[model samples]
Target: MCQLLGMNCNTPTDILFSFEGFHRRGGLTDHHADGWGIAFFEGRGCRLFLDDKPSADSPVAALVRAYPIQSENVIAHIRKATVGPVGLANTHPFIREMWGQYWIFAHNGDLKDYHPAPGQYFRPVGSTDSEAAFCAIMENLRQRWDAPPPLHELWEEVQSLTESIRAHGIFNFMLSNGEFLFAHCSTHLHYIVRKAPFTTAHLLDEDVTVDFANVTKPDDRVAVIATQPLTDNEHWTRIEPQQLILFKDGQPLYCS
Candidate 1:
């Protein structure tokens, strides 16, 4: 299986510190080294980077590690290659245009026999069940509404669709559209919110540390969600199994 990393902040923020630990799982700290990619959402536009190489060894990954691109919503993934070949098109987080926004998706689990009916509007560029699943979601949305639906309705629809997909196999994933960040936990997931009076954090996978007090102001608020905890010091809240969470403005919006 692959892994997921997501960030939702009240203000534009760079994910270099969290990404440093998360990227290592692509080849160094863990074995999900097929390929990797990330998308950073800034206003209505997004900066997406994909590499069909192990993130630990890819020069492009090195550049990203050094660059300080800032955004309010971000989604990233490191693949283990269960459904598609190790190539650029197969890498995630995959991006699509919908309702005048760039929708980003990243999956952390494998599905079995998940072929959806062919459609003219939504189709997969890569032969991965993950991409197929993304297309299916978009197609369903497009068929039901011409514009972005209400957040509550969208959450219900997404939860229902995710539940259907989980019946096939594990369906843990992260999704975002520059407005809201949605995360579903089929097995393992955790998150932490950093706000005023933030403290230092030590990366569990790398020999790096960051003191939030030195870099952030008194009003900055940020949320980091991942398949696993990235830091050792912060008390991350573990997501309950089979739960769907939507995050916006650094806070969680749960479906009722």
Candidate 2:
């Protein structure tokens, strides 16, 4: 299986700290080393990076760790390649254009016999079932509405589609369109929120800690979601199986 990481914040925030520990799982601290990719949403545009090499050793990943690119929403994945060949096109955190926005998606699980019907507008460029599922979701959304719906309505439709897909196998995933982040837990997922009066958080995979309060304003808020807890000190809430959550302004707006 792959691993997932996502960030949503009330203000633009860099993910260097969390990513430091998360990327270690790609080869150094764990075994999900087939490939890696990440996307950061800034306004209407998105910055995407991908590599078919282990994130722990890739120069691209090193650049990302060194650069503090701030974003309101971000998605990242480190793959173990359960379904597709190890290549650039098979990397997670795939991106697509829809409703005048670039949507990013990343999956952390495998699906069995999960070929979807032919899509009319969207299609997968990769061989992974994860990419197929992303395309299917886009196609379904396009067919269901002429334009993007309200956040709540969109969540309902997406939740229903994900439920239908989960019947085939695991479907843990994260999605974002610059404005909001939607996370679905088919098996394993966890999240943590940081706000005013923030305290120090120690990374579980690295020998480092950050006191967010010193770097953030009083009004800043941030939410981080991952396949597992990333910090050793802060409490991380586990997202239940089959649960879907929508996050905005660094807090969960809805859950089902």
Compared with the true structure, all predictions reach lDDT values of: 0.90, 0.94
Candidate closest to the true structure, highest TM-score:
2
How much is 24 displaced in model 1, in angstroms? Answer: 1.2
Candidate 2 — which residues are off by over 4 angstroms? none
| Per-prediction tally of clashes | 0, 0
Quote each prediction's TM-score. Answer: 0.97, 0.99
Clashing pairs in 2: none
lDDT per residue for candidate 2 within 8-118, as digits (tens), equals: 999999999999999999998898779999999999899999999999999999999999999999999999999989998999899999999999999988899999987
User: Where does the lowest 10-residue lDDT sum fall in candidate 2?
Assistant: 144-153
* Candidate 1 residue lDDT tens string, 1-256: 6889999999999999999999999899899779999999999999999998999998888988999998999999999999888899899998999888899999988899899987667899999988988998888888888998888889989988888888888888988999889999989889999998889999999889999999897988899999999999899999887899999998797742
Q: Kindly report which residue pairs in candidate 1 clash with one another.
A: none
- What does the lDDT come to for candidate 2? 0.94
